[model samples]
Target: MNGDDLTKEELLSRFLQLEQRVEELEQELTQKNKRIEEQNEQIEELEARLRKYENPHTPPSKRRSATPRSPTSDSDEDDDNVRTDGGTPGRNDGHDPEWRTVSDPDEEVEVTCDCCPECGEDLDESVGVSPRLVEEIPDPQPPVVTRYNRHCYECESCGTATVASHPDCPDEGQFGVNVIAQAALSRYEQRLPYRKIADRFEQLCGLELSGASAWHATERAARAGRCEYEQIRRHIQDADVVHVDETGVKRDGDQAWIWTFRTAEHTLYAVRESRGHDVPAEVLGEDFAGTVVCDGWTAYPAFTSNLQRCWAHLLREAEDVADDHKKGERIHRSLRQMYVGLQAWLETDPTVRERAQMHRSARAELTSLVERSETDGAVATLLGKIEGGLDHWLTFVGEPAVSPTNNAAENALREPVVLRKIIGTLRNDHGMFVHETLLSLLATWRQQGRNPYEELKRVARDNEMISRAQAVPVVEPSG
Candidate 1:
């Protein structure tokens, strides 16, 4: 009786285990199928994009058309000859063809020899010359040994005379500032990991360095340039208008955030624990006053300055409002009509005075729509916000000093956002600040009408700061 009971219990357990395994397999299969479907959808989308550029006569990946259309040019009579009906007639060189050659077929060839071979008559016997690919030679920057003088003197006339002591130099075995800068640039801009940078130094430069050594050097360089980083942040805050954006980043084993604040003429970045108002507050400083243009992120409004909302983001929001039927269709129709009317008004300005007049009228129309919607529904709420901000959109219509959009500032930080997506974030808050601050300086320098590479080169060559790796060294005693 005991054996029979135990056997029944074991059979029941095995059956339940089999059922669970089957369920797990089914779930995995479903996920796999879903992934396959998504991939197929992406392939179809890419194919559709490719079709836009596809001409039956062109090969894949290569552009098909030989000539590009000049929009404002008068139509040609023979597809090659310029119009001669009314305006000044263009020259019919006959050399000008309908289709342009990508590579020159009529390029002259050099004659190997001018002397005749078959008959005793001089003839032109030129052979086609093949294009020669030239290899670029990089400029040589051989390291020079630069010595610093430490003069020692003693005045022994009095008994209290003593020798002038010299401050200790950097450790003998560590890399110089130039080497450290190269390593930092390689790791930061080139996105190489510390160990990989160490490997590169050993293999390429005949220097044996450890990952820890590279990290120390980078940390030292970043710390030394903190003042310059602060200066860059100040520059961003002082700009006329600022655009703000954020992207997800990783820190150690957790998720983090990277904030980018860029103006048309400046850029500043700050890595924060949370994507909150404090990030902009810290980077922008306490007394910062400028027109901050950003998406409708709640924290963005906390800044104590006139905020100019991005029209592009507002347009997308308006789209959502239209999709939601909580408000009547009249709201959607109203928004569409207002935008269309505004676009038309924008094009009618022939002079500065006319442009100002047109802008004022358009703003008034937008304001009237807002005032009418004060007692209405969901669309009304959205329209009220847009209408209230109508003045911001019109601010640049006639003013040459302002930009019509926040695209320039957005463009400044787009690459950094992409980088954060690719490489993730710094390990800790300190590491995050160092990375963001240095990169901010690099980005702002480039935006401030200066060359980034040139600045980096100057820093690498002229800066005499010591890396953390060279803090201590073994001393050899002489007899």
Candidate 2:
């Protein structure tokens, strides 16, 4: 009945309407599909981000053993890969025992058979003597503390008073210079808290020192070496190249930073409230003339334009980036290739002047890498850092005095880092002052090849505050 009632035109219109409806539904479905694809891509991106960005300071032993070695990281070209016998584990069969070479025996103890046991015959000095070296420490003796008496006299003629005192003894103080120095050295170098330091002094030196007394002794040592600390700061300023680094420190329930500055002649440590540019400014001063080697910390760039960004830090970051995906691997490998090339360049031409020319050729590739950055990811973030600090990154290649990494500063900072871990924090500003001054002086003295123990003793007994020049070390350099 419907076919009979409807015209041919009406039938055609209904078919057209149905076709239009189908096209509209298809367009709506296509938009929704596009959005779903975009969402999936974003989810994958996030997942990759999560998989990457492992701790930079994580030891290689702690990393996931199941993760394959980065394809770009492996190289068969290393000389270590050349055909060689797999080295046997542990010590070799030819290992010689590290024996002590005795100089002269302190006392000669003779073991002699005065009479022949078998015959009961008297042997008149007939037995030859056999000597054996036995090394031993003498019984613990009372701490040898030498006291010097100082006498004051008054002259009747001019009413003048004078006192005669020993140079190695502290005036008016009961403890000898040695006691003060050793106790202070133990506190800082050994990272012992005052109570432990007091116990150590009491046990080892037979001097009953209270915790407060031990702290006072260290403060005195710090005061004596204040000149040396200042001298080290000046040395860094005048250095041809200086390495700088900062590490976290907790102080009195608050946070602080321990900034380490290393020069050819000295390593100086500073404790400050902030890990900002001001820290370096305090060390290097404004308009620092020397080359600065540092990590990619934002604070460092603010200090000096002549900066050598740490290649090791960058490489580790690259590895972190490469941990998850092909993009990161490509980035890591590309950066690694540049590092290798730069190293080869340095090896071929070790002179400082040759650095600029060596890196001139690689500029374009570096620029390309920097110009291209990821929106949000480890690889992108790392590339962003490199891009932002290209000059700093490449500076070492051109400056021979500047190393490619901040290892020198890092090594110098290790002492205080251990100290922080042990002692936790300085109680107040005075504590910070003592810690910084003594550590800087001790580190500088050690670098200068002076005996830290003896140097410390000499520092404690000085009557007049001396200039660094006046306090010049007389002791010969030692291993």
Candidate 3:
């Protein structure tokens, strides 16, 4: 009814009813405002995630900056080779000379002075001999090509023919085993594609080889060194600890993977169709028990009896989590503390009992952190992962066998990734096998500081394994 037509009592009643309706609408608007604020918080958290870093050591400013890298830098060449070969040290005015063994001295002119400058006469007999070392590698001798001929003879009476087989020559090909193995090294370890390898071979060795021939020779070397490859597999399986990693690859335009199983002394490579648990199972075998150090991959934990989750990966994730959530910094700080605690203890080389004490402190910190009620979203997710994977991270506390990082395996896989980028993809099954075999042997030898060319020569002769100078020794703890 219209307000003008209503009486005083009726108007009062109508005003009261309208006031109540306005109050109801205000309450509903207040509830919706609360929900919208909560939603805004969530949106902010997700937006922060876009700026998180994949590597903990990387700076947030660097990641957030839109500036592109210089055109001169190549992504493939920017990474550390994951090798222990430290670069040459700078020499000052006065420093002790570092000693190194000289394999070949270009020219040893006996630098002896037969004539004394002060005496103005020959004093060969009076001068005492003093020697100083100068090391240099002369220009390499030109690579030469040689061929072997086998003589076949027939006996008149029996009408039978016999031919002599050369130990260094392949039955079906003209190239020697050494050249073939070198070609394999060029392709797998040097990160060269097949065509480039062929070009380099002709330029350096003056040997005219087609791209197909070069690839075939590489495959032949891989096949001949089967025994050496098998030995490497056994070495990895028998070790007390193995670091495992995989990189993306393609075969005939289909996605595939290249896996590396590494120890302190040996490395083994396997190319597989899938990144599932089956690939590692095929390599490490079911029921195989040892410390498997890997990143936060679920497949590793599924099969490992004793696992050491990589702290480096954890650190990376923590950096991202902290950047993206309200309680991220807190969670990341706790992780860093745990990592530093264990890292400090390991560096100290503590006794077994001391290790237990230090680990207890770290575990206590982790437990206290996980119980906090301030986390949500990404930070909360990270906490759950850390809490669930506690045992995996703690395996290295008292055990000398386990390494704290899966970087060794990643290093082993680096060259292969580069090779994949160059070649685009593998052609067929046999090509894939050859790639795996030669890469395993080449990587193993280089890791041990041995000459792969010499190793290949030894394998082609079908000789027993020859001992090479060990760069890193594999010694079992006496307990």
Candidate 4:
């Protein structure tokens, strides 16, 4: 077995065997690396899919149902708070019965039982009477049809023709101002489709109306309210603090955006083809001096530097992250605590100096939070958003007029979003115009505590006056 005793052929054979073993090990390593690569790709795909269900932007209505958990040993303790049987079965004792009582009755009827229910005893005189008021709507009456004969006359001196105008008749349209106002209100306020609105008119008023006619009526209302809509736009530009938000919509089979600019006093909506900074620029103007309370959409900062990033949106994003990562949970808790503390501090009506100090302190705390290294992708992404809008997060703390969240704009958008769901897409540019115009007037009027229907009727009357005045042909003096 010694080296001197071994033959050259035996040594060569041993060398070949060692080489074969090394080649086999290299081949096995390559196979293991390929398997790892394949597994990594699968993991990436799974995370991407999970994001659809876990991301901050995904609404709860769209999110997937969570996996149900099995009962633990403490299930009974948890069950203590759960209402297994639908809340307390009946009304609580000591609560007085409530009902509306009309002071003056439009009409009254006496109810005297002819006989007793239990026995066949005749009862003629009533001992006591209890009055119960029932309020009901009267049956709808048919709309009135008025015919006007516009008298045409020629001026004696200039030989110019003139027409006499009446307040009862509009210059052009067949439908009256009231019908047009109702159509616009029904379409926007009630969020009814044109066809349904026409059907409602026919059913309720015994008026014959087509969907096309309903649409034209809304268009006319929109035209009349354009001035008021412009006024609201001007008001938005002049506001000290405006909450802004946008939602995606469809117009004529193309993507569009509906932007809402809202203050405490007024609300304005704009339906635009672009969801860019230009839309805000056009609405608020490039030199807008007011602070905008909005979400972290890139377009907002592009429009103006004064901003209060929505804390609700940031907290929701953190909550999304916390569902998966432990670090994210800590971040979410910290953000919630900060928000709650800020709200409580605001409630104390802090002075300007105190507000400044609080802003500085909050900014420092946010910087510290952002500085912490996050290895988890979800946590890192959330931190990235915070870091990007670090300056905006504390704007509301310094500014008393601004709100910390963009809830106003968000709430204003709910009605339009519901309308969007009902009518998938606006048919054309005219439809988009009508949508933004009528919605703006309706929202503004409601915010201002005006009856929208009555206000619209006033607008219609003004429009008729303008139209009739413009219709009169004036001839210049013959030179």
Candidate 5:
């Protein structure tokens, strides 16, 4: 009787302990389920908000134009009545109220003509006569060729020879100014390849421009315009927040990399032999101080004052984790939901513009969710990294004025990426430099709120010593 009683008591105790553990697990599951539901709701609401803000049919802010209103037929009577009141009421002012106009007048001149004085008639033809155009030359002029002969003189004492150096053209060759300008503009602005550009010159200008000559022309332009590239580099250095991305570029039958660094003010890129940290170090440098928002590449972490990891990159990582481990699904869901919350919080409320307030609210909510994720096991692993990076997550909110997304530099990288993909990078280092330098120049010009072609034209025409060409009209032939 004693053995049986003791065995039954032990069995009941074990059963009770298992029941309690099951209850605890059920409660934790319930809490996580509720949090997941709330996050989903937050995402849906935010999506709706984003859609409303991003609706393209929505008109931009309407601004009143400064032009004076034209008097309509209905208003003409009232205006006439006002004028008839002598510019006061009830008196005729002798001015036509209907006559409302603005003027853009050209220079005017008057000349007197004397003819047939005895006949008391003015001459039909005058000394200051209008010219008649009997014929028109559609393709009017040929370029004037200018030559500078460098003289060499040997001094008997030192046996040294000196010659004059022209400032605009490079030392090696006598490529025409138009040829160099055309090559550079074609490569940079038109994004044409060397062979195609040479072909185009041959077809249009009747000049047999070799691809090598075309390449050389562009290289010379890049060298001579080095000062412009330097200016862009300096601007990027001084930028407050820089977005950086790199893409593969081929050069000289070898793999190369093109790294782009850009900000609100400027964009500067370089073609490097390697995709190592040296590229970022060269572009951003060892002592770079500005905030860098980039993907989770180790190269950027060294020099940046603050590192803001790209949310888009994290999303990809989270998805990969979820696919690998089923337990990671919950964390991926949470991240997706959090992105929605961010979108809603950013766009739904126009009144909440304070960075401090936004940061505090986001941190508080994220902190709460993170604390609850401790018991979820493997699902919490990804969440833990995100929670650890919470400070960087709120970096966007820290600057209320700047956009929270790294879209600008990301977009800037896309063109180069496609170009590399299509054209298969550059044939050599010179091609890489030519591509990046011009792309940076154009990108920076657009970023500064100017027309790139217009700027190029102005630079070419006004700075003749540098560009060595007149700004010609860029017109396509009529079909």
Candidate 6:
């Protein structure tokens, strides 16, 4: 065993054996490192998935289901007394019954007792009269069909042909303005499918309408409203504050986006193939000076420097992280308290100096909160978000006109989202155009408190006039 006593060959063989053992150990170490790396990746993936369930950004409809509870014991006596039929039958005790009376009557009918039921004797004595009114819809009537004969004449003075136009007729379509307007309302406001709209017209109005006709009617309405849509877009650009948001949609099985730019008076929707900064820039223009209220999506910051990041979205994310982490809980509490305090300060109708002071104080407090060190992953992520949006977190405190949330844009998109769910996808680009134009006009009319049906009819009539003007050639007479 001693080196001095061992032979050269024995020493050499021992050295080789030691080297071989070292190589085997190195290979084993490499395999173990690979396995550890694989496990780490799996752990990260699971955490990400769990976060989706825990995060407030994930809608309740999409979140994982909670654990099922044990079945309730039907043997319990208390269960028998629970009323499942919707509460008590009558209204609450303090409420009074309300009966409507009409001031004007369209028709009147008088009734008198002609015979006594007991003895079959005719009696016509008017002592007292009680008036009762019942309102009912008249039975559906067939739609009136009118045919317009547009006569073409050649002007002898200029050798040009001109066509006579009628106010009741549209230049291009067979249906009148009222019919087209109703079809558009049914499709956009009521969110009815084309086939359903056609069926409804056929059953209710005795009009044999095809799905294609319904679609064509909507297209005409959209074309008519295109000017109004552009006007809304211009108004959004000029607004003092605008709320912006986007949601995913599909067109022809390809990914698309629906962008909403909303103000207090107007709502504009754009359907585009892109969910990038270009969409906003195109709508608001690159020189837009108004403040935009939006969420923390990267596209927004890239589009505009003037922004009020949505506190609702931030608080939701913070609330999610706070559920499991202590540091995050503290951060969430601080943020919420600051938001509430800011709101309270705004309610007092502060002067400009006061607003500036409050903004500075709130910004400092936010900075202090984000400065706190957090070892938890969720907490650190939240702090990073706060730090990233540090400048925007207090923008609303300085500007009284701007809102703290993008709820307007979100609310405007809700109806369209429901339509998307029902239809699954817009069939083509024409469908997208129809939706964006008609939906924008209808929403804007509603926001402005205008009668949608009347407004739509006006737009349809205006479009008819334009078409008629375009169709009739103007001839110049030679002097």
lDDT of 3: 0.76
Which clashing pairs does model 4 show? none
lDDT of 5 by residue, 1-479 (tens): 45466687787897899999999999999999999999999999987876554332211211111223336535444543333212334324785566435444344455556778688777775656563323333452334456877676765655555554455433557675567767877876677888999888877667776899998877766665566888888777777788887767778878877888888778888888777777767776677777887765567655554867677766656776777677677767877787777777767544545657777887887777677645455457667767767767667766644455566767788668666766775776667777887777777887889876555544443344533332232345546
lDDT of each: 0.64, 0.77, 0.76, 0.88, 0.68, 0.87
Poorest 10 consecutive residues of model 5 by lDDT?
A: 56-65
For all predicted structures, in order, the TM-scores are 0.58, 0.74, 0.69, 0.80, 0.57, 0.81
> 453, model 1: CA deviation in Å?
3.9
TM-score of 4: 0.80
The candidate, 3 or 6, that scores higher on TM-score is 6
- Candidate with better TM-score, 1 vs 2: 2
Cα miss at 199, model 6 (Å)? 1.1
Q: For residues 195-239, what per-residue lDDT tens digits would candidate 4 score against the true structure?
A: 999999999899998999999999999998998899899999999
Supply candidate 5's per-residue lDDT for 126: 63
TM-score sort, best first: 6, 4, 2, 3, 1, 5
Across 167-231, the per-residue lDDT of candidate 6 in tens digits comes to 88777768888888889999887888899999989888999989999999989999999988999
Ranking by lDDT: 4, 6, 2, 3, 5, 1
Q: How do the residues 87-192 of candidate 3 rate in per-residue lDDT, one tens digit apiece?
A: 2224535878777765664556656566778977876553455756676555534666667777888757555565655555556677776677778778776777
Q: Which ten residues in a row have the lowest lDDT in candidate 6?
A: 80-89
Error of 6 at 205 (Å): 1.1
Which of the predicted structures, 2 or 3, would earn the higher TM-score when compared with the native? 2
